[model samples]
Target: MSTLPTLICLHGGFHGPGYWGPLVSLLADKGFRSITPHLLFGGTDKPIQSLEPVIEQVAKLVAEETSKGKDVVMINHSFGSFAGCSAIKGFTSKDPSKLSDQNSGKALGIITISGFFPEHEVSLAAMAAASRTARGAPDPATAPQLPFKPTEEGLLEYDGDPVHSFYNDLPLQEAQKWAAELENMSQFVFATGGGVYAGWMDVPVWYLLCEADNMMELPQQQSYVKKARDSGGDVTTREIDAGHSPMLSRPVEVAKFVQEAVASFSR
Candidate 1:
């Protein structure tokens, strides 16, 4: 493979690839080729649902690119974590030989940011459950979250402003900027769950948990880290003081996490 690593950025629902634009540019400036696929689930005319198809598409892209000598790494945010895992399953299933080379250095190393990890038989942690069971819960009328879906005009959006509270550590202006840009967000991710999760990969994994995150909350992030660590892979954790969109609120921290994760491989 060529000597440089390719970073794939996956956005959650409602928003398209644009959510990863700033992060992609930052990585590009550092000499990394980044790819952000348009998951045509919410806004686009493309039929992008079902974890299987999405995983297949990611496998095809990884195979096509790695075949040409580019190492692949995926950095997933929120529900995009599921997508990254799905892709890994697809890649290994289609070409088991590629995975046989434990030190091939061409495998996917994922970094899930501000995401969740289920416990035991639980497939996912419902946002509603967090609210319903959460002691001292905020007034329901103040911050009500809607189930993800589409409206007229083919554009989609979601309710709940937990992100703001989650990201309270960030400067208000930055949070508002993200919120404005994120209004078109979708709820398709709400239905997409029970991913074809992989056991583990030889490649390194680093999860960036926003300490003040409100959407997934602190407890959920902890659960995810524990799962990854217990999953029998080279997993690591990086806790950030910012919110869900650390790239926007804290790009340098995110960039450094990426740099250090891929520093060992002979891409």
Candidate 2:
């Protein structure tokens, strides 16, 4: 009997594991076992301030699941995609040959939903700078000013209107509820790069582009998709008419595509 792949979900900035609740529940009904880990940056109880530790944590989780003889399909949203890709890179680098061997460190594929695709050694800060430059805006020395303010400890807190930036398609009450549950995130995570290994090149990658995303503009998303495809990534793309937080606005459709990705691996 073929073992079904495990879906490992990583949420975006200011979001904990709870952010994946809707999609996880839907995937569960379809017989998919999904694990949503609260990243160190967004932990309600304890938040870590660095990116390396977060990547290590994710890699450790993947290793633990693969050691149990289960294939992993990493699903990432927004900034979480950077951590997910970094984790995959770390896992594959430990045993490059095992990437093709399903029994050892089994990583089936990666699904990036409205996520950033950073180039090798390119930090998120740099990507943000480039985005601003593309729009003919002045480049700032520090991290780009966000809609939210950072606390005295340098943790980012979302203070902007979620309805406009994230859950534009979601109901007002539902969007407000989720927005209120968001936690503080470490600024370090966004400033760091994916390092040497470009994991997307080695694994099958599916990019879900949210066409109506306000946070990540449509053109910016397309640029990332192009970068992945041009760099020899086995890329597949599907565009949805939704905002940045599709899990809140279109959970069923998001889960359907994720299920399709898992099915492709088995075939």
Candidate 3:
């Protein structure tokens, strides 16, 4: 609300904004405004994870912050990248709103911690294709033997654990804490409609890739990053030598990378 750069952090599946707790404190220590709104999918006991509800929650938070005169720079993790894109497009765009211009000149840029960027119109067809063509498949932590059948108990296993798959790189305590607060994750957030979907903001884009990410192989993460660049989005990419969850495994280094990204945006 101080007309300063407000960094919005979005966590991925089976995780909440609490995952951003350390980084938020780090950012704030440096005179930045960092926010982590709870995503709806992380804390529920239900087996299904829908993206729409959480998307709405995030959009509302961003809009509220913006209305209070804060410029938002969204930093999304894994699946969170896709969710944030959808939420912003819906909340802050003008007519024919295919893109978000959140804080190009007014605030920092949109930084993706490493996730998918989708097409607009929210098409399942496109999302399905991406999944099939996904460079590195995102295997369900516990895929049902029946293929289409997912277990409610299996859902509870992950929801109850406190550390999602990608965050396997973190220390035990940190991982569990993150997983415990997670709620719902809809199957829809993964879809990619064939429509012309653009971010509702013009904030510059930065993708931080974990060179050793097991969940999304480096090639796959690179593929998505390349797509973002090709789409005329201003994107900068950096690779780290850690597993998928660099924030937990390498918090200090992650913070340093973010600091650099923020400075780059200022220029």
- Can you list the residue pairs that collide in candidate 1? 1-69, 2-69, 14-185, 14-186, 148-187, 166-214
Q: Candidate 3 regions off by >4 Å?
A: 1-3, 45-50, 90-108, 123-125, 131-149, 152-164, 171-184, 191-197
Write down the lDDT that model 2 would get: 0.79
User: What digit string (tens of lDDT, one per residue) describes model 2 on residues 1-267?
Assistant: 346788999998878788688898998888888989878877544445567777788888888877777778999899887778878764553345534345564777889998877667667888778877877886477655677776777777787776688888888998888877778887667777644246677678888999999988888889888877887788899999999988878899999999888888556
Q: What is the lDDT for 84 in model 2?
A: 84
Worst 10 residues of 3 by lDDT: 143-152
* lDDT at residue 154 of model 1 (Cα atoms): 39
Which has the higher lDDT value, candidate number 1 or candidate number 3?
3
Question: Regarding TM-score, does 1 or 2 come out ahead?
Answer: 2
Task: Show model 1 residue runs off by greater than 4 Å.
Answer: 45-49, 90-105, 117-156, 162-174, 183-189, 192-195, 199-202, 265-267
| RMSD of candidates 1 onward, in order | 4.9, 3.1, 5.3
Q: What is candidate 1's lDDT per residue for 1-267, written digit by digit as tens?
A: 246678878776545567576677787888888889865444544344444556566667676666665568877887666666566553442344644343333555777788644222223435336535654667888965554446564345555563454346667776666556554533343444545455244456677878877666778677657656777656777788876677767777788888877774333
Give the TM-scores of the predictions, in the order they appear. 0.74, 0.88, 0.74
